[model samples]
Target: MGHFKLLDVFAGCGGMTRGFLDDGEFVSVGAVEVDRSAAATYAANFDPTGGHTFAGDIADYTNVPRADLVIGGPPCQGFSALGKRDPEDVRNQLWREFVRVVRESDARMFVFENVDRFAKTPEFELLRTAASNGGELADFRTQVFRLNAADFGTPQKRIRTIIIGSRIGPVVEPPVTHAKNPIGDVLRWVSLRDAFLAGPVVLEPGVRDEWFPESTADFQNFQVPGPFKLRDLHVTRRYDLTSEIRYAHIAPGKSRLQLPVELQYPCWRKNPAGASDVLGRLRWDQPAVTIRTEFFKPEKGRFLHPQWENGGEQVNRALTHAEAAVVQGFDERHVWHGTKAEIARQIGNAVPPPLARAVAGVVADRLQAG
Candidate 1:
């Protein structure tokens, strides 16, 4: 069968786009992304020979190329749990652009994704109502699915809300292909160990970061992992001495709450019981928590590596740039550009490809039937 054409809006790093391409069920006719670094990363991976890869604002997309489907996850910072839920955030209004393109292009179906809380926002209600009607989608049926990436074999447990609109028929959620702690024939959730170790490039032994000359801080560098095109391995921002000492006190599966009195800071000491998982380590046996843009900082969340023995000494450092990408289900060979911080933002903002593929598999079936 001919491939169903699709367009991606706010296509940061092309995570959803990559998943569709990898699935072989759909072809991208066009994509729009506003951030320079993100758009650069997307262009580097996906060639524009297939279609237009617009690297600017979505609002400027006047003559949209037609496609059978339109898909995107608009910036969700407005409704994300990671930040304050500002009801009037400018980013929330981008969904209007999503709706406009879907209506203008007259696509048979559209898939909109965002943080779970986005479903509860007043802006979502407007987009939902708009997407349900307009052009060929009048009386369009929508299926809202709250999906956790870990349920579909991704190493990280990221819960996202997916809204699929179809003029053809009802869109059904994909069946879980993986489960937590498989019993008998049931599948088990992918563990952090599985993601980090299953890499195209392996970390070189005896290679370690040095301190910057001026500040006496750790300098970040990307290691070449074998012959893989993968860039940015083991790169990280400097952690202050105090944070490092605090991290040293915590073990894998432990957090700041476990730090000794000497290691605990004023805030942590004042409220020892609250704020669990701050400056925490990830458990090797379990799926990792959500990957956020600030995951490089242990203070932000449970991002530390599972302890590994090095010359009888246990090493417990936060996940590197590459490790975070792996956890997000990015291909091992995928290339990333820009500063470590910029890449982190791109990785954190992406939809895990495995999860997107699972959702696409179900959506493809519905569109194919029509």
Candidate 2:
């Protein structure tokens, strides 16, 4: 068979593209991404050949390159539980654009990724309608699966909805690869330590002053503090609240917000009095929480550095872009280019590369059988 061609829509940093490309059966023919910084970074990483990088809204795409497979994960913030959850959100209509491109292109298979809530939304009904109208019902078979990244070898426990459609045969969901492991086990199960040790240290200087030096003893440790009194570590900015304050703290276990109400702040850290926020230390022997775009912020979700200690000097502030890439399952050798925000956005929004590779392997096998 000829090499498979793929076009990635909403291709933030080409995570999905990387997966398909790694399979050695498919070639990324083109990609569409709206963020200029992200698109530039995607081009730098994946489009080194400088062939196709559509740096614009997917809805504006009237012509797309023909390919054997089309893959994308449209921005579903409008349908996310964290967002407005409005079924009628205008962004919901973007799926129509996806369907439109698939119909117009020569692709025989399509893979779409979105928040799990997408299946429950009226937007899904519209997607079905669009697919039917586009003649997908006549020539294609579609199936949806609820996938957990942890099930596909990612240490992070993230649930996403994956929709697969094929014109040649039924779309079978990929078998799960990794079983559920305790958060601790997930961290220890991989060769991430080896990868980190083998890679060059590429830390960016002068961004966050609170960062711990690489040589600090705290930088080498990944232990969660046992039951203990907490203390202030350092100050940094929070993403959700957009405020600058003490970003690092100590806490007992995973307990959050044990401080007196008056002293508590609206931070993502558990054990408000002790644990630090964004740059807090990660506990080794545990899977990392879902990584998000806010990872760069010290007080965004549970992105604490793995070596942080309450009242201890801040060591290893936020994760370096390369470290974030590793946790996301990208190889350390994978070069990413962009400003700090651009890189962080790419890392946060990416589909973990290992998970994508697993799905692509399944698709490749099915395609090869015929």
Error of 2 at 141 (Å): 1.6
Q: Least lDDT summed over 10 consecutive residues: which range in candidate 1? A: 211-220
Count of residue pairs whose backbone atoms collide, per candidate: 0, 28
Could you give me the TM-score of model 2 versus the true structure?
A: 0.74
Model 2: per-residue Cα lDDT at residue 5? 82
Every candidate's lDDT: 0.75, 0.62
lDDT of 1 by residue, 120-152 (tens): 777667666665546334557788999999988
lDDT of 1 at 93: 53
TM per prediction: 0.86, 0.74
